[model samples]
Target: MPNLDLWTFALNCYAREGVETACLELQSQGADVCVLICAAWLEARGVARNQERMCVLEEVAAPWRHIVVEPLRELRQAWRSPAEQDEALRELRKTLKTLELQAERSLLERLQTASREWDESADANQWLSALAPKGSCRVALETLRNAAYQTQLELAGV
Candidate 1:
């Protein structure tokens, strides 16, 4: 019981009631407009392809140069054997972990850069006085001081 408007119905018709079919319909309609709409829909859905969702996802992701078709390909491979599926999952996990490390490194680098940019000759007292009106500043400063001390202690290993 969903609302099917003329556009959706038409797209559904274009989708030929399927992602691939709709895509083909759009293509048949005209490449330029179809590709743009298809691209937007794919991006919003975070759509990825695998054998099961291949027809739909491919149509959605086709407009982009680098489409995430791994899942779809893996799904098809997995259908033949469980071991292949496990391997695909393992590979995905490894890739995700590497991405996480890279993101953390980027975040840490940005934090260090911001800290350096804020560094000045101002003493703690002066900083506290200036920031006193904003009551939370002292607490934040104390937390930062504690973290710095901990870092120093860890470096010293004592």
Candidate 2:
């Protein structure tokens, strides 16, 4: 019943050795971690790359990330320095950071459900072979793709 859907794929992929740190680094550089997760998931499912599909994914994720997740992340990061002197605030910020991650997971779930229709591509083997990672995280993104694809293939045999 629980095959490697987008959310599961994301959790497993993000848990891979370099994936979480790489994703965080990419996020800091303005990449949407949710979108990155979608990219990996779609790749795993053999969904063809569609610019319109990509745009839809971005549109769905950006507002929640901006309005909910980023603020929490900003507050958490800003509190890191202050946490050095205040143990209570440090604990609170830690809780807030965990909440932020939960929000991101919710967003990831939304992305997953939204893109399930993409199982059948409108086209096959288009010019676009990969999702572009913004900023300097290309290496990290490549790592994610390789790991995700490998994981998908591995699990497919199971």
Clash numbers, per candidate: 5, 0
User: Model 1, 1-158: lDDT tens per residue?
Assistant: 12112123223323322334333333343332222232222222223323333233234434331232334333444544454558876676566555543543333333223222222222222221221223333443333333333333333344
Model 2 poorest 10 in a row by lDDT: 125-134
Q: Superpose all Cα atoms of candidate 1 onto the true structure and report the RMSD in Å to 1 decimal.
A: 24.7
Superposed model 2: Cα runs more than 4 Å off: 1-3, 120-135
lDDT of 2 by residue, 107-141 (tens): 98888777767654546332112444434566777
Q: Which stretches of candidate 1 lie over 4 Å from their true place?
A: 1-85, 120-148, 156-158
Most accurate candidate by lDDT = 2
Candidate models: Cα lDDT each: 0.33, 0.75
